[model samples]
Target: MFLRNQWYVAAWDYEVDRQPIARTICGEPIVLYRRFDRTLVAMRDACPHRLLPLSMGLKEGDNLRCRYHGLLLDSHGTALEMPHGERVTKHLCARTYPIVERHRFAWIWIGDAELADPALIPDFWPCSHPAWRFDGGYYHIKCDYRLAIDNLMDLTHETYVHQGSIGQPEILAAPIDTRVEDESVFVTRWMPDIDPPPFWRDALKRDGRVDRWQICRFIAPSSVIIDVGVAPVEAGATVENHDQGVRGFVIDALTPESATTSHYFWGMARNFDIDDAGFTARFKAQQGGVFLEDVDVLEAQQRSIEANPDMALRVFAIDVGGTRARQVIDKKLKAQGAAAS
Candidate 1:
């Protein structure tokens, strides 16, 4: 029930290197590696012979060799060599995924290679901008990808789940503004004349009243870009004031691993303090901690959902953005399903 003809973040550029990295996406096991020229390649994890994971094998030049048997497979998943034989079999070729590395993440197309256009990938350019410094980590969450998407679309949970680090009561009390343009859901909340959240207060040196903005945008399938910052409450939302304040982009790239698990690639991309190495490293570490707080709540919520699969949870007025986001994805899925049929 997931969108197949789309680009999903497979891993950060630095995550995979000489050794093959094994990952499961959309219920299909995949093995990722790099070529001599550093071009990233993704292929079926299971070897065609005996079904041993190719990841368990070693890299042989531009190809991968099966560990169980001396079978060498090329990047295109073609069997190039076999033990005690010098024959290339056509039917034993492994399935390869169309992949492209963009904005520091390797994006893989899950279905229809012909439809996998590089332009279809989401533009998270801010993460790779020269003026911005970005860092994040991946979390293997035990939940449906939609549940994680719902978590990002609704900011109300921050006050409760992330109370220790990035939460404040004013966030929940702030009036929400939801808008949908071109099938993208945008949820904005402006908390004026309130104490800054812990992260912003420390980063921006704002001890008193501050105006904070949590602008969350939900993309198709399951990706989110959260534009957040805080400025002096009296300065208003001017370009100059925002530049003087602390600003950052919370990039959440989500991909479904199975029917009940997800691969969450989250990062913090910021425009300020790029020259300060200590500041950059510390910020990245803190942001990772804050996200783990969310992990706790999301995993707990998933357990509850699994326990009562037949029971429907009640919706609240605050769920407008999350509900709308789900609707847009559902519509896309329906259209894709009909087209395929």
Candidate 2:
């Protein structure tokens, strides 16, 4: 079951403009656009008149005019005019969702409007922080969002799936520590005084022994922020804090499109080389390629799971992080269901 009360990333800020874009979140079709003020407006994709997708309708100023019946709707999804008459029926309004643009993403609350609070949105501070440079792309993955989360929370797959990119023998040799703090799940691995992976070595721009770290944190309902980087051995970087060297936060926010599909918003925010535009572009492309590998593996895993209907997924020691994350999600879902009932 999907968590309806949480804020799901609808699209990147640039994705929504005068032209409305259609996105399905938690199985609800939504149309998102930016008004004249550049503020976001999210509403049901279907028109209130005849269920025509409003995303396909024409943009009349800040309003949307249904192409089929010519039903005009304001930014708030309120009917302003009818097809043949200027007088529109009162109370004929389409459902609008609470949307807020932050951290370069438009987040839509899919549940009770009154409960929609901007403060509840997931913290993606590095993306907006002035000291960091962040950029990435989106991926529509054909797999359950949880499977993507599972892949992220457990980095063992990196040794296989991303063998050519960021994977290293040190990562597999390092011991992982999994812990839960309230609703957050953390899986930390520190590879001390080892050769940095090619990705980190290039990011560091040096060729010396370094202490590498991968701290994967799961922030429910569906986001994993991985703190990764390396510092020269002399710099003495620790697992607690690694700002002494070039560090990056791998930002991943997954929004469920349906039971078997997800919207993957992935990026990296780095504290060092904040002014290097070339690095940002090149790295974004590289990161995109790496995640595409994940998408391929995840889609195959989903198909395998579907084919083996009688089989169950087996969890092992390395799966503690994902297991704990699933538990946290289950607990929140149970609470949400109990409250609704």
Q: What TM-scores do the predictions have?
A: 0.96, 0.98
Question: Candidate 2 vs. truth: CA RMSD?
Answer: 1.0
Q: What is each predicted model's overall lDDT from 0 to 1? A: 0.87, 0.91
Ten contiguous residues minimizing lDDT sum, candidate 2:
195-204
Cα deviation of 54 in candidate 1 (Å)? 0.8
lDDT of 2 by residue, 1-341 (tens): 79977898999887888888999999999999889999999999999989999999999999999999899999988999998896878699989999998998989998999999899998999999999999989999999999999999988888888888799877788899988998899999999999877888887888989998899999989999999888999997788878998898999999999989999999999999889898789889999999999999999999999999999999999889989999998999999899889
lDDT, residue 62, model 2: 96
RMSD of 1: 1.7
In model 1, the runs with Cα more than 4 Å from the true position are 238-241
lDDT score of residue 43 within candidate 2: 93
Clashes of each: 0, 0
Clashing pairs in 1: none
